[model samples]
Target: MVGLEMNELKKIGLGLTGFGVFFLFFGVIFFFDKGLLAVGNILFVSGVMTTIGVQSSLQFFTKRGNFKGTVSFGIGFFLVIIGWPVIGMAAEAYGFIILCSGFWSTISVFMQKIPVIGWLFQRFGLNQP
Candidate 1:
């Protein structure tokens, strides 16, 4: 459906923005940093990109009743979670995701309640509920 595609695009945008934050989260190492951590950064970046890509792709391809998005989201989440340990930076990354995801999701949900702003979305012709 067109609506599903749009929603998926939004999610993909969110996920990519989230990955950009992850880069900010872990990209500040000194030149002296070494070993498994360096290795982990590769996986971390890939995981983030992959998740965003899958979500966007699912939007383009998935049907209403299919579980592909759910499965892709789960796998993307798992890849991100597991990639940290492999890179030896699990604690920092994990904490960052929890804080960011929780706070953002909550704020967005709350903002969806305001009148004019919420109504503006309806004005644009997209279903809000």
Candidate 2:
């Protein structure tokens, strides 16, 4: 997204930024053996990041002029959340996040091929799409 449109980039940036934090936070949570208090902290942080990620992904879907991706993102996002306690493996729970996080990174690195959308995903590490 180096020389791409700012508006579109922003959407992708938001998703990448939010998803990055989400993964970092979730990974730490899993990497550690904490008590309920720690779980509470993860819950709080995840809640905030989830909201931000959703908003960003929504923008990308909307800007790309695709409602299906937006809807899928929403469903996938919620599934990631709802399936948490039921899942035995923390990695499995966290894997849901990787979908968006990995996708954001992948799209960023390949921005040239996908055009506007790719540029937006790449904006995550750069802090701007």
Candidate 3:
């Protein structure tokens, strides 16, 4: 039962994370609409927290190596909320790349299993492995 609940939670978390990314993409496509960007930021952060748990999320963000990324991300989020979507997204993108560098291998592996997308990644040399 506990395992089942955890699986469900993970599914939900993934959904939120996916939606967050979708919104962020659309936000950019829409010329960095502040509302969409802000919503994307919120959903992304909350989704990450949900997926990793609050304590782990805090630790990950507060780690010594992640300090710069964390600060940048936080400031970016703030800037977006205050109506500076372009610059805010730039900062957030930098921070997000830094913060997620460690997960690239894992992400690549996952991407490699996505059928057509996987083939595209491979063909484009985007597949790390």
Give the per-residue lDDT digits (tens) of candidate 1, residues 67-115.
4434444443454445433333444454445434526656655665778
Decreasing lDDT order of the candidates: 3, 1, 2
Give the per-residue lDDT of model 2 (tens digit) for 31-106: 5323322343344434444544556544655654444444554453443455433232344344445435537756
Question: Could you say which candidate leads in lDDT?
Answer: 3
lDDT of 2: 0.47
TM-score of 3: 0.82
What candidate 2 gets wrong by more than 4 Å, as runs, is: 1-59, 85-129
lDDT of 1: 0.48
Best of the two (1, 2) by TM-score: 2
TM-score to native of every candidate shown: 0.24, 0.28, 0.82
Clashes per model (N, Cα, C within 3 A): 1, 1, 0
Best by TM-score: 3
List of clashing residue pairs for candidate 3? none
Q: For residues 1-129, what per-residue lDDT tens digits would candidate 3 score against the true structure? A: 543466766777778888999999999999999999899888888888888778888999999999989998898999999999999999988998989888999988988899998999989999755
| Model 2, total clashes | 1
lDDT by candidate, in order shown: 0.48, 0.47, 0.88
For residue 32, what is the lDDT in candidate 2? 33
TM-score of model 1 (CA atoms): 0.24
